[model samples]
Target: MPGWDDNSLGYHSDNGKFFCHLNMTGIAFESNNLIKKGAALYPCVGFSMLQKSGIGGSAEINFGHRMLKYESITNFDI
Candidate 1:
């Protein structure tokens, strides 16, 4: 889990929940999931493989360098 430690946070797609430091925030928000703060932050992604042998998952990430299928948010400063 990405938010299992201090200074880390994660939003889950399965339950639409946010987690931080081994606890769920219990508040859900609908947005592009952006954070703007003065502190230094890094981008992260995580995956889990519970099955021993099966078809795994995949991800395609676009770090604001290409076109997206939907409208983009314009005020991100990080």
Candidate 2:
């Protein structure tokens, strides 16, 4: 699944016990507008992340048979 996130220069300040992400947060799809292209519809979830420093941050991801393709495809996370 393709993912996206905003900057993190000061996104985290240890300000609160927990942090909330912005709305319009992110989106994911099993298949695009590729029906005509023979793309099969599968389930998938996008991932989210926030880093305050290099290798420092929190990550949110989506997974499961109900959400992602169970077979016929290999998953790659970045």
Candidate 2 regions exceeding 4 Å error are: 1-35, 53-78
Cα lDDT of model 2 by residue, 3-76, tens digit: 23342112223356543332232432232233232323353344344465444334455555356534433245
lDDT of 1 by residue, 1-78 (tens): 675666667555777765543213423332224543334345677777768686567888886699988873444633
TM-score of 1: 0.48
Candidate lDDT scores, in order, read 0.56, 0.36
What TM-score would every model get versus the actual structure? 0.48, 0.22
**lDDT score of residue 45 within candidate 1:** 77
Maximum-TM-score candidate = 1
